[model samples]
Target: MEKIKISKDEVTHVAHLARLEFGEAETEKFTAQLNGILRYMDKLNEVDTNGVEPVTHAIARKNAFREDAVNASLPPEASLANAPESRGGCFLVPKVIE
Candidate 1:
């Protein structure tokens, strides 16, 4: 398997793009961590997966729902009765300034 090499320059570039400011110590730490992760991924790639089906889910699943049906709702007057203010058969609120 090919080895992964994460350089300090690449780490610094990534940090800049992510709006991060890291010191030299953090850059070195992250470079080592990222390289280790890449190595693990490389090891995983060595596994034989020929003829294996790609999985979308691990467990059997079904839509657990009932058919949609119209339900009774309160009349407009009752629905808006609790509002602090109402205008033209609709609830009103203070205007927001943007």
Candidate 2:
């Protein structure tokens, strides 16, 4: 299997691009972890998958859905009974966006 090499400089460059700053120890730790993961992926590339079919999920699945039905909803007063704040039959929340 081919070996994966992750240099400290390369890791630092990636961290810079991601706007992340890491200590020397953390950078070294991430470098080693990334190299290990790449090496494992390279090993996986050596597997024989000639007859194996690619699947989105491990198990076969079919959509299991129930028929939609109309139902009566609670009255506005009842629905907002437990709300912290309400006005004009609607929940009132602080403005979020400028």
Candidate 3:
């Protein structure tokens, strides 16, 4: 059996931080589960990863965005044509800040 890596108090503190309420039994269960996970992590640390390259993602990812290209946009005169009020080729609105 693995030694205790997480205590009941630590589990309760984490629950408080996450705004979660747990009874005594739930806290005990979580403490045991967390300790098991930490012990498994300790086992994983013993593996040799010296030759492995660090990766940002588990699998390869391709750029999902469309190719950037120059495109014509609506002219300023056309844009301000529908404004409630316009001043010097720009839309005018009420002052938002003092």
Candidate 4:
């Protein structure tokens, strides 16, 4: 793998852009991590994918949707049977947000 260099100034600039204040130890750690990721990406770039067809997903999957058919509806009382509290066929809940 090609050795990718990350300068302190670059790390500092990135930190500033991200609104992050990093100590010396954190800066060095992040610099190493970023370089390592770049090196890995470079290694991936070397891969040959000449004949392979690009696809959204690795596995072939189709949308399995059931036939849309109107059916008999449940009664309001039966539907609201498990509700903790109900008023005039509506659920009662504490008010949220101002």
lDDT of 1 at 82: 95
Off by over 4 Å in 1: 1-4, 47-98
What are the models' TM-scores?
A: 0.43, 0.43, 0.49, 0.42
Model 3 sits at a Cα RMSD from the real structure of: 11.0
Output candidate 1 Cα RMSD: 9.8
TM-score ranking of the models: 3, 2, 1, 4
Question: Arrange candidates by lDDT, highest first: which order?
Answer: 2, 3, 1, 4
Provide the overall lDDT of each model, using Cα atoms, as 2-decimal numbers.
0.86, 0.89, 0.88, 0.85
lDDT tens per residue, model 3, 1-98: 65888789888888999999899898888888888888888977888999899898888779878769978999999999999999999889999999
lDDT of 4 by residue, 1-88 (tens): 6566677789999889999989999989989899987777777667899898889878877996778998889999998899999899
Name the top TM-score candidate.
3
Report the candidate with higher TM-score, 2 versus 3: 3
Predicted structure 4: lDDT: 0.85
The collision pairs in model 2 are none
Clashes of each: 0, 0, 0, 0
Cα error, residue 34 of model 2, in Å, equals 1.7
